[model samples]
Target: MRIRAAEEPQPGVKWIDEGGARMKFLEVDDNTIDVNCDTWASCEDELHARHLFIRWAQFACCWSQGMMASKMIN
Candidate 1:
């Protein structure tokens, strides 16, 4: 599985793809993000969406911490 910043069509986007499942993220504000997902192999799109949001939140937390540490060191 791989996750990366998305380009084009929208700004402040993130995406993840893991074979059968795919997810997208859109930053609504500094503290909020909207997550969308489609799990073609499963019937629980809602559950997948929640999972994607959690993963993105984890990534965002780590990313923000890294940026803060970088700023402090510089």
Candidate 2:
């Protein structure tokens, strides 16, 4: 799967391939985008795959919490 890097990606933005498979990021940051690449590759429970997923989840959750805090502060 090829992912185009972005500076600030909108929510629900996805990439649909010819096979009709879509992958969207939950959130994006300055450096990377947090996307659900579960089915992007046929990884049958590999350690690296799991680590990537965990990192994405962590990034998403951290962004969400930061946004919430900013909203509360403002």
Candidate 3:
């Protein structure tokens, strides 16, 4: 699949499902991305977020080639 930025692109973070039950977040037009465990994926209903916690950050930068990824099962 092909992923493209918005028409008028701005610095932001985007989450996506990368098949095989794998999930990830991609940073667009940004040098770095900060993803804390307090984000919306915090609900206990999301099995992937269960181990994550508030103020918990895994990676530092999420550049185009770089990835801040997660998994979602439904």
Candidate 4:
């Protein structure tokens, strides 16, 4: 899969498959990222590929919050 800036005059990331089909649209919101997949297979594949990174990001967010709380208590 290849990720690139959207070519459709939209504000989002586009994921294209090796065969040149668009697999997903990733949009950034204020608080969340939204993914619109072309198919269930694509959705599953993308999520599977990104699962670890997603978890790591969540962990980072939580860790930062914990640090902030600890600092406030000190």
lDDT winner between candidates 2 and 3: 2
lDDT of 1 at 51: 71
Better of 2 and 4 by lDDT: 2
RMSD of each: 12.3, 13.0, 16.3, 13.0
Q: Residue by residue across 1-74, what tens digits does model 3's lDDT show?
A: 23555334544523333312223545655565433322344243454454333222432233222542432221
Off by over 4 Å in 2: 1-45
Q: How well does each candidate superpose onto the true structure, as a TM-score?
A: 0.43, 0.41, 0.16, 0.37
**Clash total of candidate 1:** 0
TM-score of 2: 0.41
Runs of candidate 1 with Cα error greater than 4 angstroms are: 1-44
**Global lDDT for candidate 2?**
0.56
The candidate that wins on TM-score is 1
| Candidate 3 residue pairs in clash (backbone atoms < 3 Å) | none
Model 4 per-residue lDDT tens digits across residues 36-61: 42322233366654764465467657
